[model samples]
Target: MTAIAVGLVCLLVLGLGLVVHVFGRVFEGDTRPTLTNDIVVGTWRGADDCTFTFNADGTFVARNVPVSLFNPPGTTAPADVARGEWELTAAIEDPGGRLATVQLGFETVGEQGQVGIHFSTRLRSNTVDGEPVLYWFNGDPDLNRRFILEKD
Candidate 1:
């Protein structure tokens, strides 16, 4: 129609094309990140002097766990060793398959022969300085401890 209208229309089309090109490039290049359970099934030591061994049999052993998880603040309990079972319940990932957070189901038996299942912890599979690490939450809410375990 009019020259001015034609110019405006052309500009709009160019802008739209540019946006589409950029978005297409974003989607075209590796949208999904790779995630594996390769190094996740192993033993790792926590910074709090705890040892967690995740076995292929879906069982796990935690030694020297902090007593604050069950006891009140400033209350110390005896040796904290827990035998439990773990399952890769859920894994949330980004569009690239990179793990955002992993959900692990942990069930431990208390000394009184009571079984407790904890589902509040979250794990992140990552590497620090080229060393593989499995990071997870530990300790009580007040303590707010984070455990980073290296494959042993």
Candidate 2:
């Protein structure tokens, strides 16, 4: 009809300029680090599974103590532990909005697990509870890596 309405207005201006260029590259930085809902017994990093517990009328528990990076040189390693039990979704909208520390769980630590455990991870700002500290910062681009927590 008119070249299909100018090809649908050039695909709606190229999908609104690709959603405003990925929302301006995630808000052009300054504040994109979340996860901190009252220092619940915690621990998380990498190289294997992690941990985090909470209790103060909120309820929480996390685990991921598994390590399986690479194997086949002799077939001698691959333990995928993945425990879970969380409930602290203060307010998470997404598209990057109102994210306070969302963790919904029902995972398992044994191999091949399931029951419910939707992954919505994101945390940083080292917390403390049992003195056994735990820092979580996967901001990436800031390889400086200093958002730390100790005593796990």
Candidate 3:
């Protein structure tokens, strides 16, 4: 009768709404920052002391940097400024049985630039150090200092 038909319609509508709600949550899940987005991106200067922009769009550009100034006060200048492009190479999880890490692939248009391009780093969990970071130099420096990654 009419009552039976009405009950079925109500149930169908409610079921459809529930399905939609669940699907929405699933789609939002992939956008989550796999614990690496917590890492910050910032500007950096190295041996040449050039000013550059480390964009979130995976492209970078630099203008003024003293090639010779990167040397120690007593050391002589290299006679060339350094500049380059950088991109996220890889992101790895720490084997502490916990998820962590992300390495970037870096290339350059000038002479002598390395994978030490990305900086302004942070962690998903506060269980790590945030200052004067210590990690692998990664095909960049024989003996390098912490390149200041100034967040724009």
Candidate 4:
């Protein structure tokens, strides 16, 4: 009888522990760093000699960017350089503004005097080695492969 009561108590404790663990993860706050104009108005560099220069006036220059960035799956020839405008905004709908994103609008001029094609990419802000860095998913975000840019 005593062993039965102890077993039941153990089961109850285990059940409560499971609920706490699940709820803790579900309700955890966003820990990513927030981006601001002052933090982003500078230069950032990534692998393959990719560089992003952000200006105070919201203008930007990107050079040596991988074709994958301009076109997903990256089958086309690489764009050597591009000029564009940039904007920063919250990454989520949180009123506290915990996470932020930098959106780059690329203005690519087509061949033979054709009109320019406009596309945009978004980078989320994070901290690495206690320094702010910008990054975006290289492929499926669930795969956890990131193309990160560090301040220069």
**TM, every model:** 0.53, 0.23, 0.30, 0.75
Highest TM-score against the true fold, candidate: 4
Cα deviation of 70, candidate 2, in Å: 40
Q: Flag the better candidate by lDDT, 2 or 4.
A: 4
lDDT of 2 by residue, 18-50 (tens): 999999987664342344455444444444444
Clashes of 2: 4
Error of 4 at 57 (Å): 0.9
Tens digit per residue, CA lDDT, model 4, 29-147: 44467778989998999998988899999988777777667665544765667777999877765577664889888886333324366788888877777788888887778997888
lDDT string, candidate 3, 14-54, tens digits:
99999999999876543223333224346544444545555
Stretches off by above 4 angstroms in model 4 are 1-16, 23-30, 72-75, 93-96, 109-115
Clash counts per candidate, in order, are 3, 4, 6, 0
Which prediction has the highest lDDT against the true structure? 4
Q: Poorest 10 consecutive residues of model 2 by lDDT? A: 63-72
Q: By TM-score, how accurate is candidate 3? A: 0.30
Error of 1 at 121 (Å): 2.5
Ranking by lDDT: 4, 1, 2, 3
- Candidate 1's error at 95, in angstroms? 3.5
lDDT of 1 by residue, 16-95 (tens): 99999999997675322233455556777876686777777766776775543334356475336566665553345354
